[model samples]
Target: MKFPAPLVRLWHRLGSPRWFFETTAPWLPWLLGLGVALLGAGAFWGLALAPADYLQGNSFRIIYVHVPSAILAQSCYMLMGSCGVVLLVWRMKLADMVLEAAAPIGASFTALALATGAVWGKPTWGTWWAWDARVTSMLILLFLYLGIMGLRQALQRPEAAGRACAILAIVGLVNIPIIKYSVDWWLTLHQPSTFKLTEKPAMPPSMWIPLLLSVLGFYALFIWSVLQSTRVVVLERERRTQWVQNFVAAEGSKA
Candidate 1:
């Protein structure tokens, strides 16, 4: 069957905030529900059912949280950079909406990565913190997330906030590669990267599969949260506009 080209064009055309909001609202409930369900299931399987590592013992279970959080932290920044690219190219409010929504979340993930890593480190590496290149690069990532958020706050106007934050986000993205390679580049104290999804692992899928599900669950939650935050931001930014006032009044009238 041949798909209609115009339909595809129309679909892409409607990816803006207004179209996205209207179209995606119905799916939000399911997205959030599935995210929660998967998170619980994955957590149980990874933390309780999975066998302890031969060397690390039960201590390795920390990977259930630490690995997912660390992966999300880096992935979130990459996603943020993609949003910045959209903002630069499309000049659309929705793109800015994504970045604005993502700032706090990305920061929280970075914090989680650092905190969970510290917890895992105490047993495995014998220290809570260190100045190794990998550790320092992750620290820099935390600060970069903070920097983007700060830029957003420093500017009151939406346009100013978006542009400033976008710049910071772009600059900060340069650190992602450095973070990924720091262990190899500088012989850092941090453990070498072992979870390359493309590569075969020494461990069997029975263990890593559940962990991967947990990562996907965290990602879904992050996406849902960012969309929610972006919606709120759009409303606040457009509050004084006629559409927003009418929209609010209509909702309030319904209530």
Candidate 2:
């Protein structure tokens, strides 16, 4: 099927590593600065200004970090899975680079979620860890990330490695839904979602507002990290190309 002219043009441009690198060059600093500012502002508002929960009190404040990390972790995986589809079906090289760039970021966020969950759990659940469905599924998501990274390292061929990693990312997508609905699907100690699209948040405006800022910050940072990483990957992979050599020479001359 033929796509609209603009969309097709955009797709072709997006697929070009050189185009992507130059296009995103000016975006990196802006994204990083915005992310840092939003995060810092949100952290202060949540920790110092937002009213403490009557029940969990100060402990509930951890949601500022935990919730955003958990949300971003899943979102990152879903992105990787989409990239996997693009790589496998269209053989888009940038999609593979994005998938590889996202893996470690997703893994790090997943680990942060697990760590903060444990910290939140210790006081609330009286345990550091549990076999709760949501928790276990999240752990599996982290493993899937590690597995992709390991698979990439194990393969000597870049094409082979990208293909293998793409397949794994696509397959591991099953765990995302499982993580999302695990609390409702089975008996577990984990609480239901704090925010839902169909319902008002369980939190008041004071709480949810700061949380929202933090979530936005996390997303901004995710984009910044992916773009920056992809840029480096583009340079490394295209080092033999004229553009990359020119870029390097320009930088060297500036220095």
Judging by lDDT against the true structure, name the best candidate: 2
Each prediction's TM-score versus the true structure:
0.85, 0.90
Per-residue CA lDDT of model 1 for 1-255, tens digit only, reads 767999977647645566666666787888798888888888999888988877667887777787788788888888888778778876767778888988889889889888887877777667787555546677888888988888888888889889777777877787678665764566534444442222324877868888888888888888788878878877887687777788899999999
Error of 1 at 59 (Å): 1.6
lDDT of 2: 0.87
lDDT of 1: 0.77
Which candidate comes out best when scored by TM-score? 2
Error of 2 at 254 (Å): 3.1
Q: After superposition, how far is residue 242 of candidate 1 from its true place, in Å?
A: 3.6
Q: Which parts of model 1 have CA positions greater than 4 angstroms off? A: 1-15, 179-183, 188-201, 253-255
